[model samples]
Target: MLLKQLSMSAILLYSSSAKSLDCAGLFKDAPTLVQGLKPFVAEIHPANVTFVPVGNPAYPDPVPDLPEFCRFGAEYNTSSTSKFRFEAWLPKSDHWNAFWFKVVLHLFELKIGNGGAAGGVDYREMAIPLAKYGFAVASTDTGHNG
Candidate 1:
Protein backbone atom coordinates (compact mmCIF):
# COMPACT_ATOMS: atom_id res chain seq x y z
CA MET A 1 0.00 0.00 0.00
CA LEU A 2 1.13 3.55 -0.64
CA LEU A 3 2.28 5.59 2.35
CA LYS A 4 -0.06 8.46 1.52
CA GLN A 5 -2.97 6.14 1.91
CA LEU A 6 -1.66 4.86 5.21
CA SER A 7 -2.53 6.71 8.39
CA MET A 8 0.18 7.98 10.70
CA SER A 9 -0.99 5.40 13.22
CA ALA A 10 -0.56 2.70 10.62
CA ILE A 11 2.90 3.86 9.76
CA LEU A 12 3.70 4.03 13.41
CA LEU A 13 2.47 0.50 13.85
CA TYR A 14 4.56 -0.67 10.91
CA SER A 15 7.69 1.03 12.20
CA SER A 16 7.15 -0.48 15.63
CA SER A 17 7.46 -3.93 14.16
CA ALA A 18 11.12 -3.24 13.42
CA LYS A 19 12.01 -5.92 15.91
CA SER A 20 9.83 -8.70 14.59
CA LEU A 21 11.86 -8.99 11.38
CA ASP A 22 15.02 -11.01 11.60
CA CYS A 23 18.00 -9.16 10.14
CA ALA A 24 19.83 -12.40 9.39
CA GLY A 25 16.88 -13.65 7.44
CA LEU A 26 15.87 -10.31 5.92
CA PHE A 27 19.13 -8.50 5.15
CA LYS A 28 18.78 -9.49 1.51
CA ASP A 29 15.40 -7.81 1.52
CA ALA A 30 16.68 -4.55 2.95
CA PRO A 31 15.48 -2.63 -0.07
CA THR A 32 11.95 -3.60 0.75
CA LEU A 33 11.91 -1.27 3.75
CA VAL A 34 13.22 1.60 1.66
CA GLN A 35 10.68 0.94 -1.01
CA GLY A 36 7.96 0.71 1.56
CA LEU A 37 9.03 3.91 3.29
CA LYS A 38 9.58 5.95 0.14
CA PRO A 39 6.00 6.92 -0.51
CA PHE A 40 5.62 8.16 3.06
CA VAL A 41 8.97 9.90 3.44
CA ALA A 42 10.02 12.77 1.21
CA GLU A 43 13.74 13.05 0.24
CA ILE A 44 14.82 11.12 3.30
CA HIS A 45 15.54 7.47 2.54
CA PRO A 46 16.16 4.45 4.67
CA ALA A 47 19.90 4.23 4.15
CA ASN A 48 20.50 1.26 6.35
CA VAL A 49 18.46 -1.73 7.39
CA THR A 50 19.65 -3.21 10.67
CA PHE A 51 18.55 -6.28 12.58
CA VAL A 52 19.74 -6.08 16.18
CA PRO A 53 20.07 -9.45 17.80
CA VAL A 54 17.91 -10.19 20.82
CA GLY A 55 20.00 -9.76 23.95
CA ASN A 56 19.61 -12.10 26.85
CA PRO A 57 21.73 -13.59 29.62
CA ALA A 58 21.56 -16.91 27.80
CA TYR A 59 23.73 -15.45 25.04
CA PRO A 60 27.29 -14.25 25.46
CA ASP A 61 27.75 -10.48 25.81
CA PRO A 62 28.74 -8.72 22.60
CA VAL A 63 31.72 -6.95 24.24
CA PRO A 64 32.59 -9.61 26.84
CA ASP A 65 33.83 -7.22 29.54
CA LEU A 66 30.67 -5.19 29.06
CA PRO A 67 28.45 -8.14 29.76
CA GLU A 68 25.51 -5.80 29.90
CA PHE A 69 26.18 -4.66 26.32
CA CYS A 70 25.10 -6.47 23.18
CA ARG A 71 24.77 -5.83 19.49
CA PHE A 72 22.00 -6.48 17.07
CA GLY A 73 22.31 -7.58 13.44
CA ALA A 74 22.46 -4.72 10.89
CA GLU A 75 22.19 -4.37 7.10
CA TYR A 76 23.20 -1.45 4.90
CA ASN A 77 24.76 -0.54 1.59
CA THR A 78 28.41 0.07 2.35
CA SER A 79 28.79 1.85 -0.98
CA SER A 80 26.33 4.61 -0.04
CA THR A 81 28.08 5.95 3.02
CA SER A 82 26.92 9.48 2.30
CA LYS A 83 23.27 8.64 1.91
CA PHE A 84 22.08 6.78 4.99
CA ARG A 85 23.24 4.76 8.01
CA PHE A 86 21.60 2.96 10.96
CA GLU A 87 22.69 1.17 14.14
CA ALA A 88 21.11 -0.31 17.25
CA TRP A 89 22.40 -1.07 20.79
CA LEU A 90 20.74 -3.95 22.51
CA PRO A 91 19.98 -4.12 26.25
CA LYS A 92 20.84 -7.23 28.21
CA SER A 93 18.31 -9.27 30.10
CA ASP A 94 19.44 -7.55 33.27
CA HIS A 95 18.18 -4.36 31.72
CA TRP A 96 15.30 -3.85 29.34
CA ASN A 97 15.35 -6.64 26.78
CA ALA A 98 14.48 -4.72 23.67
CA PHE A 99 15.45 -7.47 21.27
CA TRP A 100 11.91 -7.46 19.95
CA PHE A 101 12.12 -3.81 19.05
CA LYS A 102 14.45 -2.96 16.19
CA VAL A 103 16.25 -0.14 18.01
CA VAL A 104 18.00 2.37 15.79
CA LEU A 105 17.50 4.21 12.52
CA HIS A 106 20.07 6.80 11.48
CA LEU A 107 19.60 9.23 8.62
CA PHE A 108 22.72 10.66 6.91
CA GLU A 109 23.28 13.26 4.23
CA LEU A 110 25.22 13.26 0.98
CA LYS A 111 25.42 17.03 0.87
CA ILE A 112 24.95 20.02 3.12
CA GLY A 113 21.31 20.81 4.12
CA ASN A 114 20.21 17.53 2.57
CA GLY A 115 18.48 16.22 5.64
CA GLY A 116 15.15 15.01 6.91
CA ALA A 117 11.91 16.25 5.38
CA ALA A 118 8.72 17.20 7.18
CA GLY A 119 6.44 14.39 6.07
CA GLY A 120 8.55 11.57 7.48
CA VAL A 121 7.26 8.90 9.81
CA ASP A 122 6.86 9.70 13.50
CA TYR A 123 9.59 7.38 14.73
CA ARG A 124 9.60 8.92 18.19
CA GLU A 125 5.96 8.15 18.82
CA MET A 126 6.41 4.79 17.16
CA ALA A 127 9.03 4.00 19.76
CA ILE A 128 6.85 4.93 22.71
CA PRO A 129 4.79 1.74 22.77
CA LEU A 130 7.95 -0.29 22.54
CA ALA A 131 9.48 1.59 25.42
CA LYS A 132 6.32 1.11 27.38
CA TYR A 133 6.77 -2.59 26.81
CA GLY A 134 10.09 -2.39 28.64
CA PHE A 135 12.16 -2.13 25.47
CA ALA A 136 15.20 0.12 25.39
CA VAL A 137 15.29 1.73 21.95
CA ALA A 138 17.25 4.59 20.45
CA SER A 139 17.62 6.54 17.15
CA THR A 140 20.01 9.28 16.14
CA ASP A 141 20.09 12.06 13.55
CA THR A 142 23.77 11.46 12.77
CA GLY A 143 24.53 15.15 13.37
CA HIS A 144 22.09 16.15 10.66
CA ASN A 145 19.38 18.69 11.42
CA GLY A 146 16.60 16.42 10.18
Candidate 2:
Protein backbone atom coordinates (compact mmCIF):
# COMPACT_ATOMS: atom_id res chain seq x y z
CA MET A 1 0.00 0.00 0.00
CA LEU A 2 2.81 2.44 0.85
CA LEU A 3 4.51 1.73 -2.44
CA LYS A 4 1.29 2.29 -4.28
CA GLN A 5 0.79 5.64 -2.63
CA LEU A 6 4.33 6.76 -3.28
CA SER A 7 4.09 5.81 -6.91
CA MET A 8 0.85 7.72 -7.20
CA SER A 9 2.39 10.80 -5.62
CA ALA A 10 5.34 10.75 -7.92
CA ILE A 11 3.15 10.32 -10.95
CA LEU A 12 0.91 13.18 -9.87
CA LEU A 13 3.74 15.63 -9.26
CA TYR A 14 5.42 14.86 -12.53
CA SER A 15 2.20 15.23 -14.50
CA SER A 16 1.06 18.48 -12.94
CA SER A 17 4.30 20.42 -13.08
CA ALA A 18 5.39 19.20 -16.47
CA LYS A 19 2.33 20.39 -18.37
CA SER A 20 2.69 24.10 -17.73
CA LEU A 21 2.43 26.39 -20.76
CA ASP A 22 4.86 29.15 -21.47
CA CYS A 23 2.83 31.80 -19.61
CA ALA A 24 4.91 34.65 -20.96
CA GLY A 25 3.82 33.82 -24.48
CA LEU A 26 0.27 34.95 -23.81
CA PHE A 27 1.23 38.56 -23.22
CA LYS A 28 2.00 39.35 -26.86
CA ASP A 29 -0.83 41.90 -27.12
CA ALA A 30 -2.24 43.91 -24.23
CA PRO A 31 -5.82 44.24 -25.47
CA THR A 32 -6.13 40.59 -26.38
CA LEU A 33 -4.85 39.66 -22.99
CA VAL A 34 -7.42 41.79 -21.20
CA GLN A 35 -10.30 40.57 -23.35
CA GLY A 36 -9.57 36.95 -22.59
CA LEU A 37 -9.71 37.56 -18.87
CA LYS A 38 -13.32 38.77 -18.83
CA PRO A 39 -15.01 35.40 -18.46
CA PHE A 40 -12.70 34.35 -15.67
CA VAL A 41 -13.52 37.49 -13.70
CA ALA A 42 -17.27 37.03 -14.08
CA GLU A 43 -17.11 33.53 -12.63
CA ILE A 44 -15.49 34.56 -9.38
CA HIS A 45 -17.43 37.26 -7.59
CA PRO A 46 -18.17 38.70 -4.14
CA ALA A 47 -14.53 38.39 -3.10
CA ASN A 48 -12.87 39.67 0.01
CA VAL A 49 -10.18 42.39 -0.22
CA THR A 50 -8.30 43.00 2.99
CA PHE A 51 -5.69 45.73 3.32
CA VAL A 52 -2.73 45.56 5.69
CA PRO A 53 -0.07 48.19 6.10
CA VAL A 54 3.61 47.48 6.37
CA GLY A 55 5.32 48.18 9.71
CA ASN A 56 2.04 49.20 11.26
CA PRO A 57 0.21 47.99 14.34
CA ALA A 58 -3.16 48.15 12.69
CA TYR A 59 -4.85 44.81 12.10
CA PRO A 60 -5.61 44.14 8.47
CA ASP A 61 -8.84 45.87 7.57
CA PRO A 62 -11.30 44.31 5.13
CA VAL A 63 -12.04 46.88 2.44
CA PRO A 64 -15.86 46.88 2.97
CA ASP A 65 -16.13 45.38 -0.55
CA LEU A 66 -14.84 46.64 -3.80
CA PRO A 67 -16.57 46.01 -7.12
CA GLU A 68 -13.71 43.61 -7.91
CA PHE A 69 -13.80 39.81 -7.56
CA CYS A 70 -11.41 36.79 -7.63
CA ARG A 71 -11.67 33.05 -8.19
CA PHE A 72 -10.82 30.76 -5.34
CA GLY A 73 -8.71 27.69 -6.19
CA ALA A 74 -9.97 24.31 -5.06
CA GLU A 75 -8.12 21.09 -4.27
CA TYR A 76 -8.18 18.10 -6.59
CA ASN A 77 -6.04 15.43 -8.24
CA THR A 78 -5.81 14.20 -11.79
CA SER A 79 -3.98 11.77 -14.06
CA SER A 80 -3.54 14.37 -16.79
CA THR A 81 -0.54 16.69 -16.98
CA SER A 82 -0.97 20.42 -16.34
CA LYS A 83 -0.01 23.30 -14.07
CA PHE A 84 -2.09 25.56 -11.81
CA ARG A 85 -2.31 29.29 -12.37
CA PHE A 86 -4.56 32.37 -12.08
CA GLU A 87 -4.68 36.13 -12.63
CA ALA A 88 -4.77 39.32 -10.52
CA TRP A 89 -6.04 42.75 -11.54
CA LEU A 90 -6.03 46.13 -9.85
CA PRO A 91 -7.28 49.46 -11.05
CA LYS A 92 -4.81 52.20 -11.89
CA SER A 93 -4.93 55.84 -12.93
CA ASP A 94 -2.80 57.37 -15.67
CA HIS A 95 -0.01 57.72 -13.17
CA TRP A 96 -0.39 54.08 -12.25
CA ASN A 97 2.08 53.15 -14.95
CA ALA A 98 4.76 54.66 -12.76
CA PHE A 99 4.13 52.65 -9.59
CA TRP A 100 1.34 50.15 -10.23
CA PHE A 101 3.42 47.07 -10.99
CA LYS A 102 5.36 47.39 -7.75
CA VAL A 103 2.27 48.12 -5.69
CA VAL A 104 0.44 45.11 -7.15
CA LEU A 105 2.95 42.79 -5.57
CA HIS A 106 2.25 44.22 -2.12
CA LEU A 107 -1.47 43.42 -2.45
CA PHE A 108 -0.85 39.82 -3.56
CA GLU A 109 -1.06 38.54 -0.02
CA LEU A 110 -4.35 40.32 0.50
CA LYS A 111 -5.69 39.12 -2.83
CA ILE A 112 -4.56 35.49 -2.72
CA GLY A 113 -5.28 34.96 0.96
CA ASN A 114 -4.76 31.31 2.06
CA GLY A 115 -6.20 29.37 -0.93
CA GLY A 116 -8.85 27.79 1.27
CA ALA A 117 -12.63 28.01 1.37
CA ALA A 118 -12.62 31.00 3.66
CA GLY A 119 -9.20 32.32 2.73
CA GLY A 120 -8.99 33.04 -1.01
CA VAL A 121 -10.52 36.30 -2.21
CA ASP A 122 -11.79 36.90 -5.74
CA TYR A 123 -10.49 39.89 -7.73
CA ARG A 124 -11.40 39.03 -11.31
CA GLU A 125 -13.50 42.14 -11.69
CA MET A 126 -10.27 44.06 -11.59
CA ALA A 127 -9.37 42.94 -15.14
CA ILE A 128 -11.44 45.42 -17.10
CA PRO A 129 -10.81 48.33 -14.82
CA LEU A 130 -7.13 47.58 -14.95
CA ALA A 131 -7.18 47.20 -18.72
CA LYS A 132 -9.14 50.37 -19.35
CA TYR A 133 -6.46 52.26 -17.56
CA GLY A 134 -3.78 50.71 -19.81
CA PHE A 135 -2.88 47.71 -17.68
CA ALA A 136 -2.45 44.36 -19.38
CA VAL A 137 -3.74 41.36 -17.41
CA ALA A 138 -4.11 37.62 -17.96
CA SER A 139 -4.24 34.26 -16.12
CA THR A 140 -3.99 30.53 -16.69
CA ASP A 141 -5.32 27.54 -14.75
CA THR A 142 -2.44 25.71 -16.44
CA GLY A 143 -4.76 22.70 -16.79
CA HIS A 144 -3.98 21.10 -13.43
CA ASN A 145 -6.89 19.35 -11.72
CA GLY A 146 -6.08 19.94 -8.09
Candidate 3:
Protein backbone atom coordinates (compact mmCIF):
# COMPACT_ATOMS: atom_id res chain seq x y z
CA MET A 1 0.00 0.00 0.00
CA LEU A 2 1.10 3.51 -0.80
CA LEU A 3 1.33 5.75 2.27
CA LYS A 4 1.01 9.52 2.28
CA GLN A 5 1.11 11.84 5.27
CA LEU A 6 -0.60 15.19 5.80
CA SER A 7 0.56 17.60 8.48
CA MET A 8 -0.23 21.21 9.46
CA SER A 9 0.77 23.90 11.93
CA ALA A 10 -1.15 27.10 12.69
CA ILE A 11 -0.99 30.27 14.74
CA LEU A 12 -4.03 32.11 16.09
CA LEU A 13 -4.02 35.74 17.15
CA TYR A 14 -6.54 37.90 18.94
CA SER A 15 -6.56 41.62 19.48
CA SER A 16 -5.33 43.04 22.79
CA SER A 17 -7.86 45.83 22.70
CA ALA A 18 -11.49 45.39 23.69
CA LYS A 19 -12.75 46.56 20.32
CA SER A 20 -14.52 44.01 18.20
CA LEU A 21 -12.81 42.69 15.07
CA ASP A 22 -14.65 41.73 11.93
CA CYS A 23 -13.77 39.16 9.31
CA ALA A 24 -12.84 41.63 6.59
CA GLY A 25 -10.83 43.63 9.05
CA LEU A 26 -8.95 40.59 10.23
CA PHE A 27 -8.16 39.58 6.65
CA LYS A 28 -6.76 43.03 5.97
CA ASP A 29 -4.54 42.77 9.02
CA ALA A 30 -3.43 39.19 8.43
CA PRO A 31 -0.33 40.31 6.58
CA THR A 32 0.88 42.19 9.62
CA LEU A 33 0.63 39.07 11.70
CA VAL A 34 2.33 37.07 9.01
CA GLN A 35 5.15 39.56 8.81
CA GLY A 36 5.62 39.52 12.55
CA LEU A 37 5.91 35.74 12.55
CA LYS A 38 8.58 35.64 9.88
CA PRO A 39 10.98 33.94 12.26
CA PHE A 40 8.63 31.01 12.68
CA VAL A 41 6.68 30.97 9.42
CA ALA A 42 8.68 30.59 6.24
CA GLU A 43 6.26 32.52 4.01
CA ILE A 44 2.78 33.92 4.13
CA HIS A 45 1.07 35.12 0.96
CA PRO A 46 -0.85 38.26 1.84
CA ALA A 47 -2.94 37.94 -1.30
CA ASN A 48 -4.28 34.59 -0.14
CA VAL A 49 -6.09 35.90 2.88
CA THR A 50 -9.79 36.45 2.19
CA PHE A 51 -13.15 36.88 3.86
CA VAL A 52 -15.62 34.02 3.57
CA PRO A 53 -19.14 35.05 4.33
CA VAL A 54 -22.07 32.84 5.23
CA GLY A 55 -23.43 30.86 2.32
CA ASN A 56 -20.46 31.44 0.07
CA PRO A 57 -21.50 30.31 -3.40
CA ALA A 58 -18.04 29.01 -4.17
CA TYR A 59 -18.40 26.04 -1.83
CA PRO A 60 -20.23 22.99 -3.09
CA ASP A 61 -21.83 22.54 0.33
CA PRO A 62 -22.59 26.13 1.18
CA VAL A 63 -22.64 26.95 4.87
CA PRO A 64 -26.15 27.72 6.01
CA ASP A 65 -26.33 30.53 8.54
CA LEU A 66 -22.56 30.56 8.67
CA PRO A 67 -20.93 33.35 10.59
CA GLU A 68 -18.61 35.71 8.83
CA PHE A 69 -14.98 34.72 9.05
CA CYS A 70 -11.53 35.38 7.69
CA ARG A 71 -9.75 32.68 5.72
CA PHE A 72 -5.95 32.60 5.68
CA GLY A 73 -4.23 30.37 3.16
CA ALA A 74 -0.51 29.74 2.85
CA GLU A 75 2.24 27.35 1.90
CA TYR A 76 5.20 26.51 4.08
CA ASN A 77 8.53 25.30 2.85
CA THR A 78 10.01 23.14 5.60
CA SER A 79 12.59 21.53 3.39
CA SER A 80 13.87 21.55 -0.19
CA THR A 81 11.27 19.04 -1.43
CA SER A 82 8.55 19.20 1.25
CA LYS A 83 5.85 21.87 1.04
CA PHE A 84 2.98 22.30 3.47
CA ARG A 85 -0.24 24.14 2.66
CA PHE A 86 -3.00 25.13 5.05
CA GLU A 87 -6.09 27.25 5.56
CA ALA A 88 -7.32 28.90 8.74
CA TRP A 89 -10.83 30.24 9.37
CA LEU A 90 -11.25 32.89 12.02
CA PRO A 91 -14.67 34.00 13.17
CA LYS A 92 -15.36 37.64 13.89
CA SER A 93 -14.91 38.75 17.48
CA ASP A 94 -18.60 39.08 18.03
CA HIS A 95 -19.15 35.59 16.72
CA TRP A 96 -16.19 33.96 18.42
CA ASN A 97 -16.40 31.83 21.50
CA ALA A 98 -12.68 31.86 22.19
CA PHE A 99 -12.31 28.32 20.93
CA TRP A 100 -9.86 26.94 18.40
CA PHE A 101 -10.67 23.95 16.21
CA LYS A 102 -8.11 22.04 14.21
CA VAL A 103 -9.47 19.49 11.78
CA VAL A 104 -7.27 16.85 10.19
CA LEU A 105 -8.62 13.96 8.18
CA HIS A 106 -6.47 11.01 7.18
CA LEU A 107 -7.89 9.03 4.30
CA PHE A 108 -6.81 5.56 3.18
CA GLU A 109 -7.88 4.55 -0.31
CA LEU A 110 -7.77 0.77 -0.21
CA LYS A 111 -8.95 0.26 -3.76
CA ILE A 112 -6.47 2.73 -5.19
CA GLY A 113 -3.83 1.67 -2.64
CA ASN A 114 -3.21 5.23 -1.50
CA GLY A 115 -2.89 6.41 2.10
CA GLY A 116 -2.17 9.59 4.05
CA ALA A 117 -4.20 11.92 1.84
CA ALA A 118 -5.45 14.93 3.73
CA GLY A 119 -9.20 15.25 3.43
CA GLY A 120 -9.45 19.03 3.29
CA VAL A 121 -12.90 19.03 1.72
CA ASP A 122 -14.31 16.96 4.55
CA TYR A 123 -12.77 19.20 7.16
CA ARG A 124 -14.01 22.30 5.35
CA GLU A 125 -17.51 20.99 5.61
CA MET A 126 -16.97 20.39 9.31
CA ALA A 127 -16.01 24.06 9.69
CA ILE A 128 -19.54 25.17 8.89
CA PRO A 129 -21.02 23.37 11.86
CA LEU A 130 -18.24 24.43 14.17
CA ALA A 131 -18.53 28.06 13.02
CA LYS A 132 -22.23 28.00 13.74
CA TYR A 133 -21.26 27.32 17.34
CA GLY A 134 -18.71 30.16 17.29
CA PHE A 135 -15.39 28.37 16.92
CA ALA A 136 -12.30 29.21 14.90
CA VAL A 137 -11.08 26.46 12.60
CA ALA A 138 -7.75 25.73 10.92
CA SER A 139 -7.09 22.98 8.36
CA THR A 140 -3.96 21.76 6.65
CA ASP A 141 -3.26 19.86 3.45
CA THR A 142 -0.33 18.22 5.20
CA GLY A 143 2.58 18.56 2.71
CA HIS A 144 0.91 16.90 -0.23
CA ASN A 145 -1.39 19.66 -1.59
CA GLY A 146 -4.40 17.35 -1.51
lDDT: which candidate is best?
Answer: 3
- lDDT tens digits, residue span 16-52, model 1: 4555433332333334544432121111112133222
Q: What TM-score quantifies how close candidate 1 is to the native fold?
A: 0.28
Give, for candidate 3, the lowest lDDT window spanning 10 residues: 1-10
Q: Candidates sorted by TM-score, descending order?
A: 3, 1, 2
| Candidate 2: regions farther than 4 A off | 1-39, 42-79, 94-97, 100-145
Positional deviation of 56 in candidate 3, in angstroms? Answer: 15
lDDT of each: 0.30, 0.28, 0.44
Rank all candidate structures by their lDDT, best first, as comma-separated numbers.
3, 1, 2
Q: Model 3: residues >4 Å from true position, as ranges?
A: 1-10, 14-18, 22-64, 105-116, 119-123
Model 2 clash pairs? 69-122, 69-123, 69-124, 70-122, 70-123, 76-146
Best prediction by TM-score: 3
Q: Candidate 1, after superposition: displacement of residue 132 in Å?
A: 12
Candidate 3 per-residue lDDT over residues 1-146, each given as its tens digit: 01112221224554323264444444455445544221222222222233233322223343344455555554556656765555566666677787665554434321111135633323345455445676756555555542
Better of 2 and 3 by lDDT: 3
